[model samples]
Target: MARLLDLRQLDLEQIDAVHGRGTSWLYPLAAAMSGATAGIVISGGQLATATSAGAAAAPSGAAIAGAFVSDAALVLGLASRSVGHISLLYGYDPEEPAEKLFILSVVNAGTAASASAKTAALSDISRLTQSLVRGKTWEVLDRSVISQVSKQFSKAFGKRLTKQGLGKVVPAVGVLVGFTLNWTTLESIVDVADVEYRRRFLIEKYPHLANEEIPETFSDDLSDDADEAISVLNELAEAGGPDLR
Candidate 1:
């Protein structure tokens, strides 16, 4: 079982450290893009070369073989990229205090931002991007959403891989295909991180948003595990969890 994050135990210094670590989002974005491109380009080039060598494979057979090779390369690339990203976002030791603190902070901040947006009926892009909600307290962490983070990333990467695979079908188009694949893959990851961090920063900056209020369940799709986690977080809040200020 994955251990739950308990934010109440975090000291002020640890919170500061986590906030400071948000610098240079480009590092992870570039790393994921480059790692994925390396495998895909190499695979594409090899596939082209093999086809040119006049291998005695049927048309459909060659297509199937090419897909398998491309998929294998993409999977390997995603796996390699995930290791570094997981370490950066979730911490070197996931079960450690700092790691737990960072996870909880990200979850709570994101949950708070989403709920605030809905409650205020603020659907305008500028409202979401520019306006800050004052005096709204933190919400219970929505485990359903947080649990889907890995799945969402995988889905995004898979789509990019598929697009790149299609490009490789033309043969000898490895370099251009890899460039397109990398750009799309990194953009998806960076966009989510950018919005989440911006909300977190806004919440931290405004004094009124830091206060703890009564915690309420926000999601109708919550699992039994999610309910249990929310209860624990609410209990922590009642016990005087760390304030954003």
Candidate 2:
């Protein structure tokens, strides 16, 4: 008998598009393997080149630089708090600090920018929303079938995904995550759609990380400290790798 292979074909470009220009497999990859934030730190420039076998996308140096800026905005916007080995105090400003990060100590949301804000929070995510809105007629893209699927496909695949069909899925994920995230990033999961894919997979595979048992902090929570949420991701490659998975 022959074994069936669940082959998923993903392109470097598609991956980069979904994860945004400068996404990396580290944080998302770390979140999948380790946690959202991990004991990982690299230069703003190095992030664009880093990617793991698990990566669904790969990025370029330009994208890596984009990630740095994006993540910085998220950290300050979402105001994330301490999770895993990564603290909310970290933020990379290559232009200012030469890639050295500073922790935000206290995390807050509605009041002041601290270390608790997450991507789900409207304010936190909005930090990037305007720029994106101006760049494209988002209204038009939002109507595309790709965007449609991005909004609907929640956690249906895994790191063991095919890079092929994502032409539709990735954009959908991007549009949905990008759009919904702007409202309140932490309102849902990090990869709100991808996590759903893993959550369902975990329930079937390990059956240990239960819906209620899994640490809620790792799953979903908003923060006034949006910056904390954006720190680690600011410098990653926006291409194929475990990060997007």
Candidate 3:
């Protein structure tokens, strides 16, 4: 039997190699897969229409929106898994699975929300990133604290789902809307992961300079313009439409 790969045991160089290969195509593919899945699930069969007075009523946008939420969850989970690996590679201890999961969850939550709603989420992610770099123990965060954080994130996630549903209100264009939303969301998540991991990587490589704030240097390497992408998504969410073209 083929042995399972243990990501925790992999050294930085090995981890980098694995991540590079895995993420190069993973985000796009996952986004496409999730979008297609959402479109199909939402548009499949007669679920998109109801018979009434010998006329088929337009499919309920709410139904499509509901399907999108279920599909987006899977995409977010995949992105978070990559974020966890990057965290481990950047010196976070693998023994602290809860902490790692929490970080990933926060990052995903931040990526999902509109820019206007992202301030608190981003702040939380930054604090957690800093703590991880400082080697803080997970025990410092009690269950109540974790519960509260989880509740806040849950609310943010719900808002995001609502926005997504509103964006796909037109049943005729469900496929395109779903595709754009998933792709943009995953792209945003990847950018956040890159920044967080790169920051930690710099801190570990130059321990002497750890006390100094490192200048942001990874923007040139990002696949998408992060600010522009987030801004567009926020506008879309605010307008409650999917003019993503």
Candidate 4:
């Protein structure tokens, strides 16, 4: 089975960084840069310089440095969008650490909302009263969580790289595979991050509405029929038997 990474496992530094850049223009800039750097990471600046299988060997020196920079920007861009989306749904104060912690807790709880749920909650804050941070406290990000997340990322990338086997030796095919994996992974991360953040933001902002009872809605026709049936049964019981004419 492929190992999965939990957004909650992200350290406080990363969380804070995203919060800080939630509304900055840098995210759009990074998206533009990634379009170019992504190719560099796959071809290692030697796309056509070598045709042998060995040309696609593990990166070293400049290639390693290039890949590192490119990937970091990609991840930052992804995080920025996630935080920005939350901000759009429920305003956040970058200056508030408690709010950030609540966001982290929501990520930990993995409380994702569907499109209909999101629309309903956005329409009415009271509908999003469930709290993920209630009765929960967190002081620091655990090292084990970080380690587990790292392992999951490594395993995912390893599987992708190894799956192509000899085909990856071709720079063209490698670029296609690398780009596809990156795009798919980004989409998955965005889906989880967006939904969870929206969920937490609503609950945190509407704490007063927490635990509010929701009245169940039933069909009026069914209710009337049930009431009439019960009334008839009561009359019969009161008379000790059904009257027969």
Best by lDDT: 3
Instruction: Tell me the spans in candidate 3 whose CA falls farther than 4 Å from its real position.
Output: 1-18, 41-62, 91-98, 105-119, 140-148, 205-211, 215-245
Pick by TM-score: 2 or 4, better one: 4
Q: Residue 91: error of model 4 in Å?
A: 2.7
Off by over 4 Å in 4: 1-36, 44-46, 51-60, 101-170, 201-245
For model 4, what is the error of residue 28's alpha carbon versus the real structure, in angstroms, after optimal superposition? 9.8
> What is every candidate's alpha-carbon RMSD to the true fold?
12.8, 21.2, 9.2, 19.5
The C-alpha lDDT values of all candidates are 0.38, 0.26, 0.52, 0.38
TM-score of each: 0.36, 0.19, 0.63, 0.39
Q: After the best TM-score superposition of candidate 4, give how far the Cα of residue 106 lies from its true spot, in angstroms.
A: 7.6
**lDDT, candidate 1, 53-120, per-residue tens:** 44433235455455545553554344334323443442234343323333333222222223442232
- Per-residue lDDT tens digits of candidate 4, residues 36-153? 3554554543554565456445455576445544554454345435554554334444223334323322221221123332232232222112322463333332444333433443
lDDT of 2 by residue, 1-245 (tens): 12111111233244334443112223333222211111011121233234433233333445533433443344333322221112111111212211111112112122122334333232222222222223323222222432233222211111101111122123214333333323332222233323332333334334344424443233332243333322221221121111211
Which of candidates 1 and 3 is the stronger one according to lDDT?
3
Backbone clash numbers for all candidates listed: 0, 73, 0, 0
Give me candidate 4's TM-score against the actual structure.
Answer: 0.39
What TM-score does prediction 1 earn?
A: 0.36
- Indicate which candidate wins on TM-score: 3
Residue 204 C-alpha lDDT in model 4 = 55
Measured by C-alpha RMSD in angstroms, how accurate is candidate 1? 12.8
Q: Would you give me the overall lDDT of model 2?
A: 0.26
Candidate numbers, best TM-score first, in rank order: 3, 4, 1, 2
